[model samples]
Target: MTIRVADELLMFLPAARRGPVSRVPSDGTSTLGHLVESLGVPLPEAGPMTLGGEPADPSTRPDPGAEVRVASVPRPQPVPLEPGQVAPRFVLDVHLGTLARRMRLLGLDTAYHNDMDDPALVVQANEERRVLLTQDRGLLRRRALWFGAYVRGSRPDDQLRDVLDRFAPVLRPWTRCTACNGELVPVDKQEIERDLEAGTRRSYDVYGRCADCGQVYWRGAHGGHLEKIVHEATRQVEAAGVAK
Candidate 1:
């Protein structure tokens, strides 16, 4: 029997059970929903499935020659940011190396390890309730991840913008170590003189210390450049208004 399946729904079956709609076997029967999922699309992304213009669960089996339709779910809107609240934390997979650095520079709570395996990334994200950011589609598809994003661009600046637009976190510039996402603490200039270059010591009197790794920071020649980058990245988000 020839199955006249709807164009909207994609079908999949075990290799032995698979056949073209024009060649659908009389013995083969499966729900429009199951058929769509068998093609690799997640259920969450699939909207209502229908047969003959009536609502049909993916589990509802259809006879051969039945018409099936699968609709897609609408994309979700970005959640509003909470103001006067701590920023949402993130865990980036190994592929987002530059983005992790940029996020840390902007003082977002971000965790990154260049050598993190995919399984470890899933575990960390689930345990910490951290948003998982990755370039891998498989990682985003993990069931344990409540929040995740598939980075759309390869450029660091564009990736930064994509993250900001997706999750508008409260920006607190200069509050984290760009190299290690550690909290920054104010330190006395005289206390860390040996760590400073001669020219840096001669020019700057103020500094901040990283609480976790004891890294020292100062407003050196790079400060202005960093500040500008942070400012530009966060300006639009601030203008959009975060929740208080």
Candidate 2:
């Protein structure tokens, strides 16, 4: 059987196997999903697929010599949800600490631990109904994962953009604590004055405190840069919503 993966997905394949088309030696019973994964593309990152020019799913077993075409996941991809869930929540692998903080800065619910093992991460995701985001292809292939996505970039900024482009979660800037993924609540300046430095007291009046960890936040020198990121993410999400 022959499989033709979309250009966007070709990066996942071995250099020798990458091209417009590929030949698969199917035993005539393997499902399309298994075949595609064997080629190194995770199912979550794969978009629409067709077998023999007709629509097909991962479970569809292709006959020998059949042609299968796999596309990359579309922008603003819909996140699968369980009942009662209002929005997509995410849990990240250890290496994604910076991305996790950035997501929190945008007020997205993100859970991350630098020391958690793969099993623990999967458990947290399933128990909390969060989509697992990781750069490790092997982690995404774990059978126990409820939902998973392969993070595409090596740099934090590029990785953040890739995530926003793929799943346009609502951006609520400054509403979450970047340090703890806690909700931020407005607090009187005087209430946290003791925690603030002398310059902070004089420079700004607005303040927010993390409800979970007591971390204080204000429009510090880095606020402008953070604001830029939020603005760009907001625009990206709005555009994605409109595209839908």
Name the candidate that leads on lDDT: 2
Scored by lDDT, model 1 comes in at 0.71
- Tens digits of lDDT, candidate 2, 1-244: 8999999999999999999899989997899999999999988888999999999989998999999999998877788776876568999999999999999999999999999999999999999889999999999888888889988889998999999988988788899999989999999998889888898899999999999999999999998899899988888889988889
Q: Write the per-residue lDDT of candidate 1 for residues 1-244, one digit (tens) a residue.
A: 2333333223322455444343433335665544554554444345666777788776677777666655644222243234754677889999888899888888898999999998899888778777788877666556666766666577988898877765677788888987789999999988899878899999989899999999998878777877877988788568545531
Q: Which ten residues in a row have the lowest lDDT in candidate 1?
A: 4-13
Q: Each model's TM-score, in the order given?
A: 0.70, 0.96
Clashes of 2: 0
TM-score of model 2 (CA atoms) = 0.96
Candidate 1 residue 113 C-alpha distance from true site, Å:
0.5
Off by over 4 Å in 2: 82-86
